[model samples]
Target chain A: MTTAIARTIDAIWKMEAARIIGGLARRVRDVGLAEDLAQDALIAALEQWPAKGIPPNPGAWLAMTARNKAIDRLRRDANLRRKLDELGHELEDSAMPAEIAEGIQDDVLRLIFTACHPLLPHEAQIALTLRIVCGLTTEEIARAQLVPEPTVQQRIVRAKKKLADAGIGFNDIAPEDFDARLGAVLQVIYLIYNEGYSASSGSSYLRLSLCEEALRLARMLVHMAKEEAEIHALLALMELQSSRARARTDATGTPIPLPEQNRNHWDRLQIARGLKSLETSRNLGGPPGVYYLQAAIAACHARAVTPDATDWPQISALYSLLFELTQSPVVRLNHAVAVGMAYGPSSGLQLLAPLQTEAALRDYHPLWAARGELLYRAERHAEARAAFETAAGMTRNAPEKTALLARAAACGQ
Target chain B: MKVIVFVKATADSEAAVPPTAELLTAMGNYNEELVKAGIMLGGEGLKPSSFAKRVHFDGPNRTVIDGPFTETKELVAGFWIWEVRNMEEAVEWVKRCPNPMFTASDIDIRPMYGMEDYKEWDKEGGWLEQEVKLREQIEAKNA
Candidate 1:
């Protein structure tokens, strides 16, 4: 019975953390405090849910409990009369229809924007997004961020104070503001997904948990913002990329390039979901955001029955569009590769030449690795070897480092 | 050209944070705006400070600062790189941003070192070659 209760609590936590936090944030107008109150609610559930059995509406129970905790905290503070008065207006006379308070709301969206607010540091935003928005533990977030756990912890603490000081509120974004809000959320989710896809600091080739969390958040966003084509597009992009998780690495955990990955090992379910989401985005009849465009590009690959059948021209065009939209160095780099595949190595090299000035790419390992491969395909073996060697030196990941060295050796062969 | 957009975190270090609906929605909206405006390079929230540690050296002795840090306000949460026209433009864009914290928070902007400052080093072929090579690798890998 206890085991069953524990399992139920786990599920509830996963499904309700965002909602609980969101509701509390609205009440307190303090994300940090809201989270604290939510945790207190979670703790109460942990302690009593087993004995009480699963409540008919677990989310509502949690919200009510958290609300009570917030009230308690306010009462204890003594000088929080203004806060209490506001709460009185917000929560007063409303029926405690446990279902209504616990239902899926826009709080998660609000939380994402708050966590990604301009006042916090980038690292802090990532950490806070994972923790408060995605329900990840600090240790888990630290592992995902590839920073020392303490560093992630400090950033989160500092982030909360920053949020508090900024006085940002938890509210629905106006229709005019929705696009920008969604973009920020997508950026954070994409960052999380990328960190999992190509971890910056960990020894492992992938942290599946981070990827899963990102996908989950993307899915939630899709559900909450059904009218937003880009939201579905973002989810589609993540799902398509994530479908290759099994084939992205070997048994020994070495990285596997897309061309080498066994299509049979790809998760067909995820692919189908991705394709469906892509279709949904397209059907919405609006200019798709960069993620949507990229998802369309990803769909081109997903739809291809074989690697050789890939529509490189279309991908190249799509990437070109992305570059026009964002002009991001990263997108330009990707465009160079797509152009190379669609056109020729010479053309690709020309595209890549200008990106040489991007300072952030200086120590970035993939840049050299990609250059080496392009050089290899162009039959510049010596240069390719040098490029790969350089990449190996820049990267700290053992497997990636080994892969670069092996690629360098192959250039000689 | 050297605009730095501050992105502070919103979780307390010493205290464990659980999610609330309001927080989630705000974060989502804010991130969307940042992306739509193309001001976002990269951003994320951090874990709390207790799990944080800093390595420092005082002369011959090396010191590590373990969290929870004493001052929350003094700590930086997160940041972004924006290639705006100038600091003023960056500030204007920032001025429109919603407050990060539920109470009150500030975002700091700092310019990065530019080519002119690194001219002497560039002449020495410092990291340019490496950068190009890395870019190539990433392209090939992604391709």
Candidate 2:
């Protein structure tokens, strides 16, 4: 019964942690201290709830308990008397659901911006976001990230310290800073997702869970900022991408590539969700950002009943817009492939010409791979073979190298 | 991992009466929570056992057993398939779910098997390969 109660509290915490911490942070003006207070309240619940049974309004109880702890901490540390008085007047009934709590979403959003602050290391950002936002324990973070527990613990500790030392307050994001801050938040989520998506070495379940966690966080972000097109777009991109995850690779861990992947294995549910989110993004009506463009591209693939049904012209158009916005060599490479499919190999080769000298692409294996594909299509078999050999030499992954070499041999044939 | 959380039937659910508005709202909120947390994959409220049938197979002999079956609690009133981090997480998520039926009820969390669970038997990766192919075929007819 006690274990069961603890798990119940855990589930409630998962539902209410962000709001609780966000509310406390508003009072204490210290995100880290607010979290500490919230955690203390959680500990108190674990000690009491198992015996007392869960309170009728558990989220309220947690918030009230944490607030009292914050007040006590402030009272003990006499230097912060002014803040204590500010908090003193705030005591009241806390039985309401978290969403109905006034300005709670804004508070949570502020907390997210601080937790995913750009100054923190990428791993630290991930740790803090999972802990404070996702309500995950350090052990859970370590497990999901495939790192040692101590490492995750230290990342959380140091990340909070960095926020404190940098004097990052719990203040709402200013209008000017919103875009950059939102970008950081979105990037951290997408990074976590990519980490999960690319991780082929760990327990498959954990890796997939990481992707789900990212999706969860992204969904929360969309809730918090209902007006942001990119947020919905990011969710769409992830949903669309995750839908095909089951068929993206073969038994040997060799990538199936987009066209060759079994369209049937693509998750229709997630595709529907992606398309819905994409529609939402369009309704929000902003200049299509990187995520929006990519999601649009993914949507094209999803709408295709078969590989041949894919509207490469539309995809190439989306990539062109994407390349114009980001000017990323990777996007250019993708655009080349789309152009090749929609137009011809010669058109793709023309787009690749500038990327040939791109300093960033000189060592990039995919550039060579794309070149090899285009050249093979253009009937320059010898050139395609050399390009494939170069790609094969550059790749560090064994399966990828083998695949590239096989392609090279295919060109010879 | 994923789990199928079944809301076991109580006498109240077996009656096939619609839930009270309060219960419906509570469940709606609970479902929204599940979706917001990104754990709810899919779920449905099942019709009572009076409308269900069980096919029993004994040594290639097939028999259809009609409902309503006598085992009241054994029948499922509803179920949810959730993608969760672990059995613990699944249990925790289910713990907060609102009462699925009037009166006392139980929600059983059964962790589904994944490819990794059968890795020991997949000496040559055949199981994993076949699982992917099987998923592909299932989608072929539906997706």
Candidate 3:
């Protein structure tokens, strides 16, 4: 009714909707149905809440409302008989055990798995995740992924139908299947966070919302599978990076280098949360997953009081572990930058020498960006300027281009 | 007031229609806000004009316009329906809503007529009642 009321309701919904829908999907075993029921509940709220006043526990209220709507739909739909037979007679939402919340998380995780399912193209998986699980509309998903909106819509529709047709149960898969699904989940989360950290396109460099969603999803995974050290590590890594969000950009949305950023603006709470999660990974006591290693590296950054105080050696060591685990050219490129800081630019440049020929990374803007940094550090200003120029040319984001161009100018100066 | 918010999509404004991971994240947050507010009533973006076409008729003639239309600004994107108290309320909400693009964008809102607007039509009803009933049935099926 009023601006304040609308804003308050909006804030609560953003925080709670994912978990509520996740929980509902687990019960219904149908992503589309779960979303529909959730929306129905939202509609009921829109009609009722302004007059009744906000509920004391809005999340529980929404969940309860969604459950009721699901039951009502089950009763009223023409296919009720067959649907009940398939879902079992005890499919009422209110009767759902507390364990179903856990089930919902599993569904959310399963939805992630489905979106990231290897059967579909990478673009399709991304588009589907943003659409189904993230509750983003198809157009928004398309805009985020930089594909045409129809392309995104088709991918999502196909993704959902594929999941339904494949008879992919929302609950447990085989160990191998679980691993495959988890890999997809990790990739989707990483993609979302990476996009937020440094936008692939657009005028602004940082997108706090996408980063926050990814971080939240990652954390949900951690809670869903606590013993998985890699999950904890990934969560920690995301949290640590997110801690730097406020310091990532200037007032005009230009990229701000870590060293130049006002560290005070970094979220101390997020840094603390990240470190705690990292501790959880360490306590699990196995070789860290790729995400864990990266989190460890981020933790080093978080712990540092100043740029000079950063633990380059430790970060370099973590990157070494990550390189061994993932073998991604991008990982190696990052390791090279860390090595430049840990030892000397010569060693880093030597490592980069071989990578320059790596086909996978030939067009990667960050590879050239790292090379430029190494050369600049080595005082090969002219070569560094060329590298930065190349990086600036390759990048699509305005802020990243600005950063690279500024670096290139400094190289000649 | 039952307002039909028309969401028109166009790809002509930019060379690339694909959103970066970062922009998706921001847009995701914005959508979450909309959904939470209870203003969102069925919204989605369509594919580019390349996969789309329009059919029209003049007297008994038929015409088709393939997508990638020269005038994208005039194109109709996807839209949402909001049941607010009045048009002024809808305008206030739209004014505060985030611009979907970093460049610039606009949304068009049109009010939908309900049963109350049908008094004169009802008085002259012949096949209109049957048409209205059929429409209701279709809406129920879709819902």
Candidate 4:
């Protein structure tokens, strides 16, 4: 029973910690102090809840507890007495104020933007966002990204200290910079999702929690910035890609190539959600951004009930638009694949040939894999076998390596 | 909102032994109740920490440490992600779970943040239209 209660408290803390801290940060105007007060509330819950039974509204309970702690702390500080007087009435009230409750989402959004501040390094932004916004422990963040816990700890600590030293307020993002800041925020979220979707170097192909976290954040962003077509596009792209997660790997966790995957395993709900978001982006009525174009390409595949039914021409067209928008060699490589599907192996090969020496694709595994597939389709078995072997050697993911090696063997046969 | 209920690892779980059939049946029945109530989103058991590894990072340096490192109390054995109205509803469901261990065990519940929480941020006023439509599509697809 003691263990049960302890676990319950632990769980509650993980869920409410961010919100509690975010709320207090708004009230206190100090992230570090807000976090400290929230931690105090957690400790209090740990000490009191097991004996008292869990509170009725655990989140509100924690927030109220933290608010009281903040009030007490402020009362002692001569400099903060005026602030304390301002907050005292609300803190003393048992019921949380409606405005405070309504502002929780804003607080979280502010917290994420602050964590991903442009002044901070990319790694620090990621570490800080995972810790503060996602409520992941240092150890869990380390494990998720395959970094050392202390390294993650250092990044988080340094990030916090940097923000404090820079005198960056939680609401520092100016209105004019909202679009640029939103771009940074979207980039960080997409990076996390991509890492989860295709781990840079891991045995597993998917990390559901990271993907879910990214999706959750994207959903939140869309809600926050309703008219932002790019946000909707990004969300649509993630949803479409994530819909294929269940079919991306075999029963034994080995990756199955897209063509061989059982479409029945595709998450129809996610696909529906993706398509809906895509429609919203279209309805918003602007030229398609990179994400929107990619989402359109993904939609082409998702709309197909079978691999053969896929609209390769539409996908190829979307890729061309994506290439024009981003000028990314990776996009071009993907476009090559679509071209191959729509046109012929030789046409795909012609597109792939330019990218082979494009510097970026030289050591990229997918580039080699695509080349191998195109070559195999052209009946250039020996060259395809060699390309498959090179692709197999370049990849670090275990499942991807296994699939590549299997493809290489098929080429030999 | 969704909540993830974590089942804490016990000494037996740390030892990597499977649960007894009776205990499994009990847990299954509990899961069935959750599903029947339309609360369960997903659930799964985890392998022992023996298969886990921790990477310690020091700036640019990294060192790996093997798991099964004598911290049974801190490890997770399994978890169930449930969609519930609030933390209170989740707690009520958790209170009915059978003991998940041969010995003493504990379950913890944490709520998942949702897009609805930020609905007020729609300054231009149509921000949540897409999200609402998408959610309905998801519900219909699931149904």
Candidate 5:
């Protein structure tokens, strides 16, 4: 019944849900309750909008309705009469706009940080962020993460309960802890992006929608936190990497190597945006951060017209800077790959040699994969095949396994 | 989604009249804003119905229709392609546009079809495969 109205409201919900939820969470002082109130407002919309026709300003309507529900709930349930009075007076408004109140963008940021609070498990944090900030449905998150819908729903429910039990206020963050907290939020967004980019744990090779969702989240952050260099840089990195999406996978979804990918298929529009963002980040410069460095590397790749034309030395230098900053074994591995491209294959092998015994990368398939590539270039075919086979065996992802095995088979030639 | 926003032909636009310097400057600023916001992909203005041709094909026969067609209301004087989150976002952006013509005019937004739109009919993916190849070929030819 009223399928068309319901569908329009669904689209409207995606656009307004986060703001309405965030705005209410600030007023009600509880993320979970705020979300429930927002959902109630949505149900009200579904029940009434079809017969009454959609409102002139739907976002404002939703906000006004949610505010009423919030006020009623506080009056009916709360023992803190004084707190309710303050909220009641503060909330009693004359007029509202489609966007919301001033500093409401802070509520959006607060909502993100609340969802990404360090207390929750990383998976749960990610699940909650997808639900609250990205406004994705439980089913969509489930499909994107390749988990069952009920599992995602349970994860979100548990995360909310954890936040509430811990007495975490939806808009509360110590100003002193702001930078570290923002870093966590950025890290969570990056992790979601990487999960989609490589799809490490799933049967599928790529979740393109996840990548897009991450871009949307990053873009939103860039808008809210305009002064933050890392937010812009993170957005830039995602944009540059996403530009290759069409060329990165084949018809069957097997990954195509960067050197082998067709440049013509790259999204020039996204590359331009990425470069512009990188420039913005640079202008707001504080020594280059992880995202800025990575975005620089991606920009190098984006600028290259052909494989031979790629500025591998600059990429190697950027990776070296990144490794110096992060000191992460993964970054070191990437540095080795970039160095191999810039110098001879032997230099790569030399750099990669220490990683062999490094406990952190002991069984990482990418290390072996890098070794396989370098060894193949060194005319060490048998070693290359063995390394490829090792990588093929170690990887859990099906398409990566297929690609590695194909490499191993090719080494025989 | 990518939407092509068509600025409809008003009588003023059909006459190919130049805009006042102030309006021109405002439009220029608007375009610059679009570029800075990273929404505008590309755009151009038409030279009205003049210097235009339409090839009408029926069966094996082809009829070439010359320019200066009637019905200015249906004509598009210009357009800009923008990548936006949804039609609502597109509409919001269009609402911010300066009135293109000195007189009343209209604009239209139409979403472009991407490869995914054909997914249902391309069960075996042959059509997708062929489309990709065709795209590459066209690009190469144009290049």
Candidate 6:
């Protein structure tokens, strides 16, 4: 019973911590102090809840507890006493006011924007957002990102101090800079999703929790920034990609290439959701952004009932547009695959040849993998085998390595 | 609104043992009811985490860890995405579900965000109008 209650409290903390912090930050006008007050309330719950029964509305309980702590701290500080006066009767109120309660959503949104401010280093921004907005412990953030716990702790500390030094408040960011700030926020979320979607160094291809968190954050952004087409596009791209989680691997956990994945295992609902979001993005006007183009490419695959039925020409066209947008070699590599599929293997090989000496493609496994595939398709068995072996050796992921080695072996036959 | 209902993994689920025929039939019948009521949009069981892996990131560095993770409570056995009117309605529907496991189980329900949640952001003309029209187009295309 004690363990169950403890578990419940922990779950509630994860769900409510962000809201509590957001509300307190608005009340105190200090993000750092708000987080500390919220932590104090959480500590209070950990100590009391296991002994006493859980509260009826744990969220409200935490909010009320944190508010009282804020009021107490203010009363003790002479300089902050005037700020306390500004808090008015809302602090003394027994129940949470309707407006303050409704403002919680806006508070959290503002908190996210503040955390992802362009003033902070990109790494610091990501760490701060995960810690504050996601309500993740430093240790959890460390584990998820594969960094040392102490490093994550240091990053969080420095980030908070930097924000305080800059005198940045929850609503301090200007409307004129909203787009630039929103761009940074979207990039951070996208990076988090990509990390979860494909672990660059891990044996597993996907980390569901990270992906889920990113998707959740993206969904939140879409709700908060309904005017942004790119937000919907990013959400659509994630949903469409995530729908393939099941089909991306075999029963034994071996990696399954896209062409070989069983269509029946795909999550149809997610596909539907992705398509809907994409439609919303397109309807919102403006030229296709990188995310929208990628979603369009993913849509091509999702619409195909069979691999052979895939709209390669459309995908190729989208990738070309994407290439023009980002100029990323990775996009070019993908474009090569689409070209190979749409036209012929030789045509794909021609695109891949120029990329071989491109500095960015030096150690990229997919570049080699694509080269191997194009070579194998061209009936150049010896060259294909060499290429697959090189690709296999480059990849750190076990399942991918196994797949590549198997392809290499197949070339010999 | 849409919500995801997660069925937490247990020791038996972690071991990858097959469910009994009775349990399967019970779940099938329940899913049918959900679909018939248009509550369940989609759902599926997941393979055990032993077949899973984790990749940790430190800056640009990534470290991969194989799974058979010790934390069963944190593991998910299956999940369903359902469209419902509100959290209360979702909870009521979840209460009707047959036991998905041989032992005691826990189900966690979380709300999925919708466009209406951002009504505050609709003040600006251009994009919000397009979002609603596009959503309608998607529904029509799917329909």
Candidates ranked by TM-score: 2, 5, 6, 4, 1, 3
Best by TM-score: 2
Model 2 ranges with Cα > 4 A deviation: A1-16, A42-65, A82-106, A119-121, A146-151, A201-205, B9-15, B46-75, B115-126, B129-143
Interface RMSD of each: 19.0, 3.5, 19.9, 17.1, 4.7, 18.6
The global Cα lDDT (0 to 1) of model 3 is 0.70
Q: How good is the docking of model 1, by CAPRI class?
A: incorrect
Segments in model 5 whose C-alpha atoms lie over 4 Å from true places: A80-105, A199-206, A396-406, B12-71, B74-105, B132-143
Candidate 5 to native Cα RMSD, angstroms: 5.6
Candidate 6: tens digits of C-alpha lDDT, residues B6-43 = 99999889898899999889888988656534345578
Error of 3 at A254 (Å): 2.6
What DockQ does each listed candidate score? 0.01, 0.38, 0.01, 0.02, 0.21, 0.02
lDDT of each: 0.73, 0.84, 0.70, 0.78, 0.83, 0.80
For model 1, how does the per-residue alpha-carbon lDDT over A257-354 read when each residue is reduced to its tens digit? 88877676677866987999899999997876888899999888888877989998899899988988997788888888888888988888888887
| lDDT, ranked from best to worst | 2, 5, 6, 4, 1, 3
Question: Which residue pairs clash within candidate 2?
Answer: none
What is the lDDT for A297 in model 1?
Answer: 90
CA error at residue A223 for candidate 1, angstroms: 1.5
What class would a CAPRI assessor give candidate 6's docking? Answer: incorrect
Compose the digit string of candidate 3's lDDT tens values, residues A334-405. 888889888999999998889989999877888898899889888899999999999999989787898899
lDDT by residue (tens digit), candidate 1, B16-119: 45446787787778676554433344555666677789888989998988887767766666566654433544655566556656556778888765432333
Write model 6 residue lDDT over A1-413, tens digit each, in one string.
Answer: 87766666765676677788989998887788899999999999999888887776677899999999998998899777665454444345434445433433378788888788788887788888888887778887777777899998898889899987776766555445666777888998988888777752223322445676777778767766677899999989999998887667543445568897768768897899899999999999999998999999999999898999999999999999999999999999999999999999999999889999999888888899899999999999999999999999999978789889999999995
Question: RMSD to native for every prediction?
Answer: 21.1, 4.9, 21.8, 17.1, 5.6, 16.8
- TM-scores of the candidates are 0.64, 0.84, 0.61, 0.69, 0.82, 0.70
**In model 1, where do residues sit more than 4 Å from their true spots?**
A1-7, A50-56, A76-78, A84-105, A143-153, A172-176, A199-206, A356-360, A363-365, A380-398, A409-413, B1-143
lDDT of 4 by residue, B1-143 (tens): 67889999999898987888998899889886565343465689998899899899999999999987687888899999875545755876787788888898888887765433433365333544465456658856986
Q: Please write out the lDDT profile of model 4 over residues A1-413, one tens digit for every residue.
A: 88777766765676666678889887886676787788888889988888888887777889999999998998789766664454555445534345433432378778878778888898898888877777677887787788899999899788878887776655555556776888898888888888788852224322456776677677766765678898889989998998887567543445667887767768786798799999999999888887889889889989999899999988999899989988999999999999999999999999999898898777899999999999999999999999999999998877778889988999875
